[model samples]
Target: MKKFMLITCFIIGGFATAQAQQTSPVWPGCEDAEDVKACFNQKLAQHVRKNYEYPQSEDGEYIRGKVKISFTITEEGKAVVESVEGDKAEVNAAAKAMIQKIPDMEPGTLNGEPDDRNFTVPFNF
Candidate 1:
C-alpha cells in the first residue's frame, strides 16, 4: 500500500510539472491576452501585413513566390531570424528583412524561467 501511494504521488507530481512548463511567448500588446498563441499569430500576421514590401524586379515584372522563415525570440525578447527559404532571392531577402523588424516581445517562460522560443512563418507574395 505504501509503494502504491508513493507511485501515485509521483505520477501526479510529474503531470503538474509538465503543465507548468507548457507556455507560449507573448507578443507585444498581447501580454494581457488569455490565449497567447492566438494573440501571437494575429499580431504576427498584422505585423507582416504592415511591414511587408514587395521587392522591386529588375525586369519590371511582378514576382510571386512563397518564403518560409524560421526565427528565434531571445530571452531578452528580441527577434533573430535564422533562415529564409524561398525560390526567389528577392523574396527570401524581403522575408528576412521583414522578420528582423518585428518588435520586441515578452520572453517565453518554461518552469517559470525565461526561455528562447522558435517560431516559423510563411510569407506568400
Candidate 2:
C-alpha cells in the first residue's frame, strides 16, 4: 500500500457588499472579463492556492483550521488585511500573509466614484 497527503487551500466565496450592483474592481488579466465579479472570485481562489502556506504547531504537526478574513481593497487598488479570525494564531497569521499578497487591481466604484471595497471570506487549509 502507498499513502501520501495532499495539502491544499480554498476560498469559500465572498461578496462586494451592498453596492455590489456597482462595477467591481478588475483583476489583472480579468480586464476583458464579461462578468467581473466571477473573474475576481476565480482570481482570488488562484491567489490563495498559490500563496497559502500551511502553519505548523509547536509540535511540528501541520495545523488545520478555517479562518474568516476581513479585508479592504482601497481606492488606490491595494488589498489590505483588516483581521483574521480563527482558533489558532499561527493559522491566522499564515492566512493573513497569504491574503496580503493579493496583487493590486482596478478599484471598484460606488456611485461612480472610486471607493474602498470590503470583503469577508472564509478560507480552509
Candidate 3:
C-alpha cells in the first residue's frame, strides 16, 4: 500500500511538471494551431526555404557552409536578429537577411503574461 501511494504521488507530480512547461510563440498564421510549437517550426522552415538565396561570390567560386542565426521575438511580435555566425561573409549576410523577412508572430506567454522568446536557426548554403 505504501509503494502504491508513492507511485501515485510520483505520477501526479510528473503531470504537474509537464503542465508547467512554457508555451512556444505562435507564428503569424499558426495562431489557432493545435500544436503551436510544431506549427511555428514548420512555418518558419517553409518561409526560410522559400526566401533563401545563395549569394554570388565575386571570384565565381562556390561557397558551401552553414550559417547559424539567433533572434528574439518581442512582445509586439517583431523578429530582431541578435547575431549571425558562419564561415563565409556572404552566407552570414544571406542568413541575416532571411531572418529579417520573418513575419511578425504572436508573442509567447508565461502565466498569461507576454514573454520574449529566442530562436536559433541554421541556414545551409
Candidate 4:
C-alpha cells in the first residue's frame, strides 16, 4: 500500500492494500482536493471519457469489449501502463493508449520517500 494509486472508479476492487500507503498521488489539477482518492477517481473518469475512442475492426464494425489495465505512477510522477488484458487485442491496445494519456502528477509517497505507485483501471468499449 505504500506505493499504490488506488481509486474508486474502474479500480482494482478489493485492493484494500492501498490503505497502508503514506500518501496517494496528487493528481494534476487536484493539488487542492481535500480527498485525494475521490479527486483521483473523478479526474480519472473524466480523462477516460474525454479520451475514449472505439477502434474499428477490419470487418467494418466497432470493437466492443472490456479491458483491465495495470499502470504505474513512477517516482518521477509519470503514469505508465504496466499491462492490459482483454478479449480483443484492439480493445487492449486502445485502452492502454487512453491510459497513457494521463498527465503526470506529484508522486505518491511511502515512508516519507517518493515511490512508484500502481493502479488498475477497467475500460468498456
Best-performing candidate as measured by TM-score: 1
Ranking by TM-score: 1, 2, 4, 3
**Candidate 2 residue spans exceeding 4 A from truth:** 1-21
lDDT by residue (1-125, candidate 4, tens digit) is 53455445326655555555588988888999899989999999999889978899788899899888999999999999999989998888888888889998999999679999999877777
TM-score of 3: 0.78
| Weakest ten-residue segment in model 2 by summed lDDT | 4-13
TM-score list, all predictions:
0.83, 0.80, 0.78, 0.79
Q: What are the lDDT scores of the predictions, listed in order?
A: 0.88, 0.87, 0.85, 0.86
For model 3, which pairs clash?
none
TM-score of candidate 2 versus the correct structure, residues matched by position: 0.80
Score residue 84 of candidate 3 by CA lDDT. 95
lDDT of 1 by residue, 71-98 (tens): 9999888999999989999888888888
Query: What would the C-alpha RMSD of candidate 1 be, to one decimal place?
Result: 2.2
**lDDT ranking, high to low:** 1, 2, 4, 3
Select the stronger candidate by lDDT from 2 and 3. Answer: 2
Please name the candidate that would achieve the greatest lDDT relative to the true structure.
Answer: 1
User: Candidate 3, after superposition: displacement of residue 1 in Å?
Assistant: 26
